[model samples]
Target chain A: MKELEDRIRQDGIVREGNVLKVDSFLNHKCDVALYDQMGAEWARLFEGKKVDKILTIESSGIGIACVAATHFHNAPVVFARKTESKNLDGEQYRTQIKSYTKGRTYEVIVAKRFLERGEHVIILDDFLAMGCALNGLLEICEEAGVVVEGIGIAIEKGFQPGGKSLRERGYQVESLAIVSGMNAETGEIDFA
Target chain B: MKELEDRIRQDGIVREGNVLKVDSFLNHKCDVALYDQMGAEWARLFEGKKVDKILTIESSGIGIACVAATHFHNAPVVFARKTESKNLDGEQYRTQIKSYTKGRTYEVIVAKRFLERGEHVIILDDFLAMGCALNGLLEICEEAGVVVEGIGIAIEKGFQPGGKSLRERGYQVESLAIVSGMNAETGEIDFA
Candidate 1:
């Protein structure tokens, strides 16, 4: 986590909308070494949990989730696909989510065969902002009667309500680096 | 490669329109252990190549690229973002690609900073069928002035023109499993 925080400070670009673009290491351009470290740390945190599978979303979450699965004894990773339109198939569990980054709503879908009843799933993602995407994943798990073992996030906007709301709900959520606050002018990042 | 071919035969669905859906292992629902093996194989194939980075597209390719990077000494992985419309930006290299699967053409964008001139880049992708996505990535490498060492494809549809055309052009293309033919009626897969 320290390494991640330091890397964010050194490479993260701050935009006007409280957006900390760690594209240098986190999102667009990925550091597999950093991802491996984070994955190992998540495995340590969820060591005792009976995690049957890892769930994440498409695009950004795939890399982190895939690497993190290695730490969990190579659990299968199931990414919920996002589509602008609804899927007519009744075979998939669907949930609508608002995109905090792109400022639109989309449906996140998972095939019914992927998640089943009584499975312990760990949800992983790159960024946790207002928690819309995570909520959508959780909704799919809930619909399938799967219990969420924990949530592992690479970076969390701590000033946002997502992390806080999950903790308040008694969910064990671990974020590699949590940005408590950001100064756009000074380019200084505060961590929690 | 034998394991991959076996997975394709067992779990891969032969859908209408010749779409071999390996959503169970390759794309949607990912098998992490299988991906680890894939990474090792890619590492073995690209042995001694000075690959500074692994380039791939968003969504499906990200997972494989990240895992594959581990075998390449933790080389960084950069994924191109797909957009419905092109954005005029001097700091990015963009390419237009037609997706036969998605039924539309989209623009894939990679920031100028991530891809450097003369960097040895290896393009990795899930499927090589028509080669639209792979060609788009290769174009980005060209615009960025990066040297493409080669392409590593998980599955190449040999019946299609993608692999044959790239091979004809003298590109060092390697496919883990090349499907020579597929029969939806008999549910049989022939690999070359």
Candidate 2:
């Protein structure tokens, strides 16, 4: 966690809209070494939990989820699809999520074939902001009758309410780095 | 490669319209152990190449690329963004790729900060079909002045022209499993 925080402070950029851009090593351009360490940390944090599978949103979450899945004994990682594809089966557990980053509402879906009843699902993602995406994934899990094990995130915008809301719901949410605030003009960031 | 081939024969669904869905292990629901074997096989195939980075498209490709990066000495994995996000910087190298699966044209962008000029890059993806995605990625590498050491793919639809085109262009392409044909009715799969 210290290493991730340091990496964020060193490489993260504060953009105009309170966006903490970590494209250098977190999202767009990934550092697998750091991800390995983060996965190990998540393993330690979620140790002894009944985690049968890892669920995450597409694009940014895939890399982190795959890396983290290794630490969870190479558990299968199921990523919700953002776009409709003919390849996907017609019967699916779907939910709509509003993306603050892209400023659009997109449908996230998981094929019913992947998730089943009584499975412990660890919801993972790169960032947790308003909790819309996380909520959508949790909804899919609920519809599939999958038991929510815990939530793992690489970074959390603590200024936002997602993490707090999940905590209120009695979910164990673990974020490696939590950015409480960011200043675009001064390029300063505050962490929780 | 044999392990992957076996997985394909067992779990891969041969759908209508030449679609072979391996979401069970390769893409949507990723098997980290199988991916590790895939990464190792790619490492073995592209041995002796000077690969400084692993470049991949987002969503499905990110998981494989991240896992594959481990076998390449923890090389940084850079996934091209399929959509514009607040986190992406203003400066980037972008390419338009026609998706055969999705039936549309979309832009893939890599931050200019990641792929450096003259750096060796290996592009990894979950599937290789019409070669449009690989061609688009090659264009990004061309624009960034990066040397594409090779391309690594989990499955190559041999019936499609993508793999043949890449090999025709004199680029070394390693596909873990190449499918010669698929019978959707009988669920029979033939691999070359």
Candidate 3:
């Protein structure tokens, strides 16, 4: 976790409107070593829990979740698709999520066959700000009748209420790096 | 590669409109063990190539490329963005690509800082049908002056022109499973 926090401090860019750009090592351009470490940390945190599958959302979370799935005994990763595609035709559990970064709301879906009833799953994603994305995944998991084991996040905006709300809802959320505060003008970030 | 072919035969769903759905273990739901094997296979095929980075597209390719990067000495994986987002700011290399699956044209962008001039990279993707996606990535690589060491594909429709055209272009394309023909009615698949 220290390594991730340090890397975020080193490469994470604070932008206006509380936007933290970590595309350098987190999202667009990925550091697989860091992703492996984050996966290890999550494995340690969720040691005793049963992780039948690792669920995530497309575009960003796919890489991190897939890499981290290696640490979880190579658990199968099921990423919820953020867009409707010709390839995605089947019975699916769907939910709508508002993207703070993309400035639009989109439907996220996972095929019904992917998430079976009574299966245990851990949801992982890159960032947790408003928790809109995670909430949508949770809704799908509930609909599929899968047990929510825990939530693993690479980074979380602690200044926002997303992390707190999920914790209060009794979900064990493990975030490698939590940004408590950030300043775009001075380019300073505080970790929680 | 045999394992991949066997898994495909077992789980791949052949639908109308030349769609081969292997989402059971390839794209939508990923088998990390299979992915690790793929990475090792690509490592074997593209061995001795100076791979500085692994480039891919978003959604499906991200997971495969990140898992494959571990075999490339944990090379950083950079995935091109298919949509504009607030998180994607600053200078970028952009290209227009037509999606046969989504039935739309979208702009793919990669940050200018991710692909440096003279850097050697291997482009990896989930599938190669018409090669529209790979061509867009190749265009970005050309504009960035990056050397494409090779292209690794998980599945290639050999009947399609993508693989033939790319091979004709003198690019080494290693497809784990190349489908020469498939029947939607009988669910028969032939591998080349």
Task: Give the number of the best model, judged by lDDT.
Answer: 3
Please, what are the lDDT tens digits per residue for candidate 1 over residues A110-157?
A: 989988799999999999989998888887888899999899998999
Residue-level lDDT tens digits of model 3 in B1-192: 899999999999999988999999999999999999999999999989999999999878999999999999999999999865444556888899998987889888999999999999999999999999999999999999999999999999999999999999999999999999999999998999
Q: Give candidate 1 regions above 4 Å deviation.
A: none
Write one digit per residue (lDDT tens) for candidate 3, span A1-192: 899989988998999999999999999999999999999999999999999999999979999999999999999999999765444556988889998877888898898999999999999999999999999999999889999999999999998889999999999999998999999999999998
Residues B57-126, candidate 2: write the lDDT tens digits.
Answer: 9888999999989999999999988864444456888878998787798888887889899999999999
The candidate that wins on DockQ is 3
Off by over 4 Å in 3: A85-90, B84-90
TM-score per candidate, chains pooled: 0.98, 0.96, 0.97
Question: Which clashing pairs does model 1 show?
Answer: none
Task: Rank candidates, DockQ, best first.
Answer: 3, 1, 2
Give model 1's TM-score versus the native structure: 0.98
Residue-pair clashes per candidate, as listed?
0, 0, 0
Question: What CAPRI grade goes to candidate 2?
Answer: high
Q: What are the Cα lDDT values of the candidates?
A: 0.91, 0.91, 0.94
Candidate 3's DockQ: 0.93
Q: After aligning candidate 2 to the native by TM-score, how far in Å is the CA of B47 from where it should be?
A: 1.2
